[model samples]
Each structure stands twice: as structure tokens, then as C-alpha cells.
Target: MEYITLNNGLKMPIVGTGTNTYGKENNDYNGEVKNEIPELVSALELGYRSIDAAISYRNEELVGRVLAESTVPREELFITTKIPANEEYISSKEATRAAIDNSLKNFRTDYLDLLLIHHPIEDKEQLKNTWEVFEEYYEAGKLKAIGVSNFGKNQLDDLKKFAKVKPAVNQIQINLKEPNKELLAILEEEGITPVAWGPMKTEAHQQEALDEIGKSYKKYGAQVLLKYQIQRGVVVIPKSHNRENQAANIDLFDFELSAEDVEKVENL
Candidate 1:
């Protein structure tokens, strides 16, 4: 697997497993809800070193279970979780500390490889305060890296102005249908890495353009889309229950999409 170094000199895998089943439109974790632990185990068995979960997902404990049971060393794996966006949760610094403490208990780990604010909300000051607490955790060696999710350029810029530590990543939705070039350009300019959620566009929409491009390389449509995002330097977490799909998602290191092929998908 390929990796990217954060601003603070931490290395993270380019592709990972995202455990976000609650707010997603159609895809449910199903009975696999209980299987999240095993699913993470499966992902690790399949060579996935990064596992993304959130407090809202309600499966961090299960993920923790798997991590504790697995033989994989904690240092070899990248475990990430986010602060929930609920008003009560983000309203106070105490709540933020409790949330992190809960996440640590849930994940059964001493430190988080990365942590993020789940989304932008009405309380900028509270958010900054929460980030300050995260910085404290980083200094205390409880969290290795910190970032935000679903934030646009202005929000990130605003945070940067007063933030003691620049965000190492900005997790956002990026797929063929929602290219988000403007935001991506801003992230690139600021030297913040982009972590793409729904790299295949949630489950409802399929881009035929991706299918057409996939035919050229004999790759699956989703694989083509993921490759496009990776070429643009965005880290992707394409969730799938099927082992084949998971394996295929990480098999992208073998081939490079041509400039012409990239343009075909880009223009589409």
C-alpha cells in the first residue's frame, strides 16, 4: 500500500477501511453491524493497516475488540476516530475530553493515529476550543495527529489563522460526480491532505463515465474512480463488505492511468 506523510511527519496509508454506516443513505452495516470487529479483522488479514471509525458509528468498541485480539501490533496499524457533531457533544471542552476518553476505551487503544472533528457546526469558538484540547492530547501523546472533516476552504482558512497546529487532513466527499476541484485546489495550496469519503459516491449513483474508463484498463468501475482520486493525491476509504471488492480496492498499485485516460475521466 502507498502512504502519505502528514505535516507533522506521520505516515498514513493512502487507502483504508471506513466504518461509517449510520448516516449513509442506503448502505447499512446490517448483521455485519456486529461483524465490524471481524470486518476489521478481515481488513487487517487482507493487508489493510488503516481503520477509520467515528464515535457516532457506535462500533468503536467492536473495532477495539478486534484490535486487542488480533496479533497486529498497535504501532503497525493506523486507527482513526472522530468527534461526533451532536450539539451536546461539541458544545463543551469537557464533552470533548470525555468523547476522546470514550473513543480510547471503545477502540481499546492508548493513542489514536488520527482524530478529527466530524463536521463543521454553528459553534466556531467551541470547535477551536475542542481543537485546542486535541492539541493537548497530541502533546500528551494520546493522539498522533488531528484534523477536520467536511470543512470547506473558508472554514479551514479560518481555523488556520488562529490554530496553533494546522490541520493535517481535511476529510471530504470526492468522487467522479462530485469532483470538488475548487476545494481540492484550496487544500493543496494549504498543504493539507484530502481524505475522500464515499470515493464511489455513496451507493445510489453510478457514473457511466467511470465504467467507460474502466473498460480501457479492464478494471472495475469503482476501481477506476478510486484510481482517479489517488492520482489527484486524495486519500480514499472505499467501504465494502465483499472481500473481493476490498482486495481489488487495494490492488491499485500495479497500474498507472495514462494522462489521456485521466483526462477522459476528468472531462467526464
Candidate 2:
């Protein structure tokens, strides 16, 4: 329900739907989770305007189908997808173009709100070349904005050095328990919006504190956790199949967390 203006001068939802499924660690890319369709539909019904997906997630086709059938007009939705760093795909201009084309076809959209280099290439030269192409796509209007995911400060520096267009966002796994403050500071200094992928599953988050904080705002622990990230100026995409949870993630604009409460959550 909140928004962040990216370095590229575009507004991105501060909270959205993340579509990575279970068993993603086991190489089960795109296992066809039938629930995502209804989950996304329900998210839209509940006022979620953003959908974060990636090529490696393997559910683009189905998600696209849901997007096509949803009652909300396409312009109202913010869609983002990524290109994996695998050699086969980014080996050449032709392959990269093909991969992006496939995403457009799958999403059933003419353009994407954002696109990212899904992961950093181990090879810096290759990474540089890949980013150049992404910039080309941005210039051509194939992608509205481009960014990187799971990149460390060093890699970000390299990309920034050669970049014609600065990255709009950087998505990584960050939570209240272990906030990765060093990287967060770097991103803040660089003017790139930080996006938290797994904002809820934090090992250090204080449940008692979260529950208590939620009481003052009539929110739950998960909502409090998400609110912490939003208040600190990070974007979040917390996915859920449960309608109640989906609604809670977007129902975050009503109240603001006090600086004292936010600091308490951070210290926890």
C-alpha cells in the first residue's frame, strides 16, 4: 500500500506478492502450484498492486494467465521479472533477447514495469556486458526499469561503475532479526531502493514484542514485521496462499510505527 520512487524516477509498491514456491531449494523450479492463481487474484482483490516474479520461479506462464483474466486493468498492476545469470541464457545478445521475449509472451504484457539480473555473474566482464544489454532494453522501452537481485556491495560497485543507467532496485533477503545493516547503509548511500524478499521469516525477530506492537495498531506479528521494513525505507514482497495473510500484507498503510517502537524492533 506504500510506494518508493526508484532511482530511475518510477514508483514501486513498498509491499507486493512474491511468487517463489516451496522446494525452490531442491531445484523444483515452477512446480505448478495451482494455488498461486487464486492467491494472486485474492491479493489483487485485497488491494495488492504489485507482483514480483522471476524466470527461475518457473510459474510465469500460469501467473500470466491469472494476470490476463484478472478484472484489474493491466496498467494498474506493477509487474517485475528477472533474467537468470546462467551461461546458456545470457551467453549472447540473441539468447538474452529470446529470454526477455519469452517473459513478455508468458506474462502476456507488452512491457514489464521492472526487470532484473536475477543473480550476479561470477565473471565480472560478463556481468558488465549483461547489464549493458539490460540498459539497452530500458532505453528501447522493453523494460521500464532494470535492477539486480542478491548482489553484494562489490558487485553493485562494479555494475555502477560501468552502468549507463543506475539500477533502480536491489532485492535481497532481509528481515528484522538480521537486518544486514551494512548493505542497507550502502544501498541508502547509493540511492538504490532495497527490497526485502523474505521479510517475515526472521530468526531474531521478537515475537512477544511484535505481537504487543501489533496490538496498538490492531495488526498481527507478520504485519508488524512488514511495517518495520516499510518504515525503514525498504520494499517488501511477502507471499502467501492464505487470503487472510495476503490481505494483511497490503493492509499496512493505515498507521505509522513510532521511532521508539521501530528502534525497539531493530534492537530485538
Candidate 3:
């Protein structure tokens, strides 16, 4: 798999798997945790090293157990999990510290590859406190990198005012349905990597166009969509339960999209 170098000089896989529904009943995001995630096992077997998880998913312990139990060594895996913005996690500096500590315990790791605030903290005091705690962990060598998810320019600017270390990445929705062009440009200007969630969500017409483009390269529309994002220096975490689809998600290094085809995708 290809990698994106973050602002902090750390390398992250350009393609990863999202685990919002892993270990949940009926594969539902809000479903109860049932203790096993065969899909995660399948993903690891299929060569997916980047695992995106969050506290809000309510299955961190289970996900962490699977990772700890897997044959893949910790050094070879890129594990990313988020701390929720709720009071339970971000109410105080100590609270945030405890939350992160618990997450480390759940994952059975000495250090996490990356940790992010699940959402923008509207209260400036809370935001400052949370970020400072993140900085503390990062300095202590527990969290390799710290960042924010679903943050707009205003939030990022707010954080920048008191932040000594800049955010390494901004995870946001970047599918064709919500391209987020302006924010993407801002991230580019600021030297921050953009990680796209819901990358496969596209209109039928757009999918058809990608399919036509993929024919020349002998790839699927989903592969073309992911390649488009990575080609432009954006990281994509597209998850799939189907083994074939999982294999296809990471099978993106074989070909390159021409300038003309890229423009066509851009216009779409």
C-alpha cells in the first residue's frame, strides 16, 4: 500500500479500513457489541494494516483485543482511534488523560500510532484543555500523533491560536457527493493531510463515469474513486465486509490515471 507523510513527518497508509460497525450486532453502527469481528480478521488477512476506530463506536475494547490477538506485530500495524468530544471524555484535562490511558490498555499497546478528537469542541476552554492533554500524551510518547476530525477552518484556526504542534491530519467526508473542495484546498495550503471517510459514496452518474474510466485500466469504479483521492494526495479509508471488495479496496498500486482522465473525474 502507498503512504502519506503527515505534517509531523510520520508515514500513514493512504488506504485503511474503517471499523465503525465491526464487532457490532447485525453490522449496525449502533448495534450492540457481540465480542468478535471476523471482518477485521479478514481485513488483516487481506493486507490492510491501517485500522480506523473511534470511542463513539462503543467497541474499542473488542477491536483492540482483535488487534492484540492478531498475528500482525504492533510495529507493522497502524492503529488509529479517536476520543469522543462528549463530557465523559473531554470534560477535564484529567478526564481526557484517563480516557486515553484506558484506550491504551484496551489496545494492549505501549503507544498508539495516532489519536484524534472525534469532533470539534465548541467550548474554547474544553477545547484547549483537551488539546493540551493530547499534547501531553504526545510528548510522553504514548500518542505518536494527535489530530482532529470533522473540523472546519474556523475550528482549525481556533486550535492554531494556542497550539504548539500543528495537526497532522483532518479526517472528513470527501466522496463525490460531498467533495469539500474549499476545505481540501485549505488543508493543502496548511500542509495537513486529508483523510477521506465515506469515500465510496457517489452518485450513479459519477459511478458510471468512473466505471467507463476504469475499463481502460481494468479496475472497478470504487478503485478508480479511491485512486483519484490518493492521486491528489488525499488518504482514503474505504471499508468493505465482502472479501472480494476488501481486496479491491487496497489493490490500487498497479496503474496510474492519465491527466485527461483525472480532469474528467474532477469535472464529474
Best by TM-score: 3
**Candidate 1 off by > 4 Å:** 22-36, 202-207
lDDT of 1 by residue, 1-268 (tens): 9999998899999999887662233446542455534456667889988888887776777778888788999989999899977766777889889989989988788899999999885567887888888899999999999999999877887787678988999999887667788999988988899999888872334566677778878887778878888887899998876778888888888778999988877776
lDDT of 1: 0.83
lDDT of each: 0.83, 0.84, 0.93
What is the C-alpha lDDT profile of model 2 across 104-213, one tens digit per residue? 99999889999999888888778877888888889999899999999999999888788999899999889865578999999999999999888887553378778888
User: RMSD (Cα, Å) of candidate 3?
Assistant: 0.7
Model 1's C-alpha root-mean-square deviation from the true structure amounts to: 2.8
Q: For residues 212-237, could you state the per-residue lDDT of candidate 3 as single tens digits?
A: 99999999988998999999999999
Stretches of candidate 2 off by over 4 Å are: 22-36
Candidate ordering by TM-score (highest first): 3, 2, 1
- Per-residue error (Å), model 3, residue 254: 0.5
Which of 1 and 2 is ahead in TM-score? 2
- Residue 121 alpha-carbon offset, candidate 2, angstroms: 0.8
- What's the best-to-worst order under lDDT? 3, 2, 1
Q: Give me the overall lDDT of model 3.
A: 0.93
